[model samples]
Target: MSSVGGGEECTVTEQQLLPPPPVPRTKMGCSWLFSLRTLAAGFSLILAVLFFHPSLHSFLVGSTDPNNPFLYVRNFHVWTRRHPQKAQDLSMGSRSALAATHFQSKQTYIIIHGFLGSSTDGWILSLKDALLNREDCNVISVNWSAGSTTAEYFLIQPRVRTVGAEVGQFLSFLEDTAGLYTYQVHVIGHSLGAHAAGFVGKTLNGTLPRITGLDPAGLSFHQADSADRLHHSDAVFVDVIHTHGCYTFLKMWEDCFGIDENLGDADFWPNGGERQPACEDGGDGATSVKDGSSCDHGMAYVLYIESIKYMPSSTHFLARQCPSWKHYNNRSCPCGHPVQYMGFNADPRAHGVFYLNTSRTAPYGLLDSDCSAGAFSLVQIIGLMMLSILLVLLLLLVGLVLIQQYFGLPILARVRARLYMEDLVWHGLGKSPSTHILNSDKAVDT
Candidate 1:
């Protein structure tokens, strides 16, 4: 019995120690799966690189050094009609040159461009020409392309506050050394630059005369507090033009460019504030940002340029205060109220939302010959009254037909007979000959 037990244990140990048979290897299937995974990983990496290129490049090459004012703040290239061909580099350190320069005590117009813009842009030059043509004011085109031209909008946003401080300091230097006053300074900014101008005004403690925000930027600042954005208190008078303010649930790339809030004393919403005439839709916000299809966003400055070109003329581009675009379209608001002109001629005292219609092409102003003329004419009123009366009579006839249908035609017949008898009695007419014959026949039958 001891020998048998030992033999069984030895057999079990041998079976446990024996090696298993080799499994079949599917090299082709394994290689195919591995190749597919490698290809998918490579594609995903490429997409990630493409998507993060802008931010990465901004981080690498963007001016993050706070001490280097030249890269961030001193890049402002000042341009005037006197030197339209050249630009003057103004910085905090260079006080002697600015003091001896062509800046006078006259109204100084500072034009600041939005994201990815330059001082030599065609619109800037055009605006400079228009302003110089109209008045003898000093036009300074604030060019901070060093900070503004970055592909990453987020990277450039922080630099705007610094640029504004630099600009405010520069304005102060002008007051101290160049004989320019804050009241004489009018800063006109488009898009992101508009908020930068607000920063400048805030830095100056709201002493600046006026700040014209041409569609102040909506992204990163739309829902920001008043301290962070362009508020009416930023300057003595603030006027805003909402040309590309898009309010929708799904904000496309191009749609989120301009703020819809009224950040100024007077807010002008031209053509309902989103779609402007003559501006073909540029697909979406991303496409517009890439292809420069920001016609609506740029229209604010265009309208402003036109206004400057034709100043002090109350006839062109007349705008009236309205509760909404609906009221403007319906022409329900009485025209007898005092009118305010949009753009450069906008009254500083004008306080509220103003509405106006513009043409699809250039010279966009709608001419108003008479301010007191009512929207509806006498003939229109009479026609409307007649149509209303006809509608009421038709409704009454329909009601009567419905009643007769529901209550039976016999009831209607009886009502008509009773009405006829009443009319005869009221007229004092005796019974007809037919009735008398019928009565005699009845008496003979009886």
Candidate 2:
């Protein structure tokens, strides 16, 4: 070897070590990320659906089960002067059983109670007695208490139509068997029962002579279509008593335990149809009188009962036609306006909205026009305005907080990041590859 010149220019092998090949992206990782994004999206979609369609919640998860056969059974307890304490059961399926009882062919009055109430409630019994004393007519108490009392309010609401249908069928049976005219029938209902009575008139082809709704329920039926809830067209004469017509907390609009809309031929609004004096908060702003807020709701039937019991001396409950309660309070109502009784003696011939005042205690009817009870002080008006504004702001703040919380989730963050990368890629693909590469390099460098 010519090793004499270069000291062991020995063979040295230089092996260039290339970096280990990048670990191939795992399918499991990509799949897990995709699944998480899909799950979050699906959950948000479901929440959105429920937020928009509220009735579906009542229909899908109602308080009463439609499959239960017991829900269909409705009992009509018939009482008269001949059988005052003892009520004979009248069934839709049976004819002879009802005929053998003390069923009369006189003016028949049907009394129906609301949610969580029974045919045997103290008020119901008292009403039955009062009606019997007033005349020798038949007093029928509808007993759907089994179905109406056991379920949640929303659950029982839809079943009111069923109750109405059953009562209508029974009335038809009376028409065929007892030879009774539809005009001779008068239906009186309280709260949810009032709407049920409306359905009854609908079932009878709007032939019922009278329908009296005592504080008809407002929750589900407030915005309902005319055909679905109590309406003036449901009967020849419909009289509505709005005692608790507007909930206090919801004063921005009329929403209450009792329906606020004038759904009858004669709409009687007592004490401005919002809160009763007897049910108002005491000076402490914490204590309520009598049955609390329910005092107002119950006053409708109480006033009706008084009208029936003291018919001769019941002129005190008389109401005057006015455009609004404010006008009535101001005594600015035009002279020669129509006037009507507020309760049981409400004349079918008289029509339009009516307003009246009542005492703060039982025997509540006022002797004269006293709109003093409805006048609002300047302080009260300012307080109410402030409260409404505060409530609106609170609701908006809560909504924003919820939205921020929802979007701040780690999964949501991952989804957003992935979407952003996809967006970049999509727009990049729209441009020339060289331009994209240049822009990306510039971004990395910056």
Candidate 3:
């Protein structure tokens, strides 16, 4: 209180001097403290949390296990039926789906067909067979609104949720039932089917998804609008087979809205982006995606499965393991030994040739954003710690502004705010908690 020379005294309420008590101190049975010592302890806890549970609580939350990616995933199936109503939801009848079920390596496939397509469309069988023949994959040729409409149109129409839902179920089967933990799963879709593949890859829950859209359906009504929903924009192995652009290289390159714009990868385009008038113009009205016989939309999968040989990295394109199983500079198998491709055929369509070439390997982890497990997880945990610490500090400083509002010891509340209640309580109750105080002056005698 201040006294005026004119004989008037100014009185100040204790309320204005302190802030509110912290919640940690108010809990009925919980102990709270407000002192420099407690702050030191709280700081120590932050370090301990980071050091102890680095995998779960630290930044490594979604980290990948390089030695064994299969640890958390289950095997993925190729062809399976969903609830009947599920098909109708997307205005699509369950065109029969067929996928080869075999896993020689960690590779898996989720293949899709185009509009008005059935399991029999271009290279459908060959693609499945080729992928299955590999020691790595279990290929699934998903059937979703095969011919109903352009993905741009149907993806937005409320009914597409049916396809989305079924795709979600398929992914669940891999995670929950199949135990597809450690291996890599690749997705392949042609045209609208390609979009569906994108959706499946985008919607996958736990493990990151790898996708290869074979001549992705034209238009962005769906891909761009529902980007985060399905397409990661940066997904790995997102290939687009431009057999549709064979003849009119310029046209294919110019069609920004359809075949040309979304090839997803540069090297895999028609003619390797080189012009081939003979193949494109051989048939009348040929070299256009809509033209059926000119090897437009129909032949993409055909060439993919039947002809195109791959560079070692192209295994990602077919959602299959490279026959040789060698990755990155022909590194030997983990046992410090090399795996042989007895029937390694470089000819992609030769089925069992020695050497061949096609698409390039996808940028690592492009398909699944979380595939960089260790790095991503580390970042996540660090972020969480920062958030937790920031909250603790906020509570302490803010609590000081309103300390007198509660009946508890105000200074004790401030100290407790600096210490995360979890760490404090876990360490056990304080000694002589009954001596806790309100202010620096009040604590001196305690």
Candidate 4:
């Protein structure tokens, strides 16, 4: 307090001299971070349901009924050298389909696609084009998408068998009606379609000349009996290309989306039959999440396509009859072991679990290496270590950001409160915590 000469009094307190306190902080709640995470998780779950629900249904509810009315061959798009760009749609056992084809004793190829696949897929189209380029052969692209896809995926297996039977019946009809030989046909299938091809062979008493299984699906078929899946005995010559091999969750390092077992007379494991070079790293045990598992699975047909396209070139993939990829890596296979060409030109006589290496991109085949095991170079190892470390750091940083968003940056709050409290307490001065300054300061400390 102070008195002036004119008897006027004026007063000023320490509180008034202090700066105004900060506004109380609002409690953090779920924000954009939470919504984003929830959205991502929901999307991933939906994808998993769509991809695995059918397989899960098959596994839990076994398919005992072989005759499913819903499953049937929708159409067979027949193509020849004359009609390479366009396909002539044909119906099963229809004389029109047989007559439309320019089949003059040329090789007949039946291309089948897997679950949720159509005859118009890129690989199927490329394969059809290649086959036409190779010779004046009869190329039939089977569109059984209806049977291959359903709301209840569990029915796919039985439906696949039904479609296969229908295809078999159609071939038999061609045999009787158009003088075509069923034994001269070459059946090629991918994933579920591979097993359909097997059923086709089974219907004909295992008389088809060849059946190629491209990265056959492993979900429900991995442990299936020979009769239930594509088997070596399904055809006279069955060559399987295993780009993505299946491994249990415990063996996540050997991750893939396709069956790894030897289900054919000749089983070729390119890039160790598991991970491919072009896919994302699986160091975090998230092969499906990180890599999408497409590169490995799709590489099967890519290799086959190249095999057909580069038939005359030395860049074609050559494989060795080794017990396993490790043996091939160590060059431990017996000297007397036979060398085999993989893909479209695979020799029927060379039958075994063959292993080989491939490049990272297009033109995947190596020129001439006894066994390029695809071992990581020193630079690659260093790069992989850096990637792993970076991945860990990135995960940690994300965790911190989420925490800050929810908890209001606990570390920073604590530091600011300590400094403010120390300034007041050390100066031998204290204010009511209810004051705007103390409330705002304590909110951070709390």
The TM-score leader among the candidates is: 1
How do all models score by TM-score?
Answer: 0.66, 0.63, 0.39, 0.63
1-446: candidate 1 lDDT, tens digit per residue: 12574565323566677798788869998999999999999999987775567644433454443533544443455656676667676655566556545666888888888887776677777788887787777888786754344568886776678667778877887888877888899998888889989999999999998999998888878678888888999899999998888755567444658887788998989887777774754323222222252878887777778777654444567776889999988887554233577888877866888877777777776676655323445767788999999999999878777888987655555556567666766776538774466557547745
lDDT of all predictions: 0.74, 0.76, 0.42, 0.75
Best by lDDT: 2
TM-score of 2: 0.63
lDDT of 4: 0.75
TM-score of 4: 0.63
Over the stretch 130-234, how does candidate 4's per-residue lDDT look in tens digits?
888887788888877554445454566666777688788878777887777876699999877888898998988888989999988776676799998899998
Pick by lDDT: 3 or 4, better one: 4
Ranking by TM-score: 1, 2, 4, 3
Quality of model 2 by C-alpha lDDT = 0.76
Worst 10 residues of 2 by lDDT: 283-292
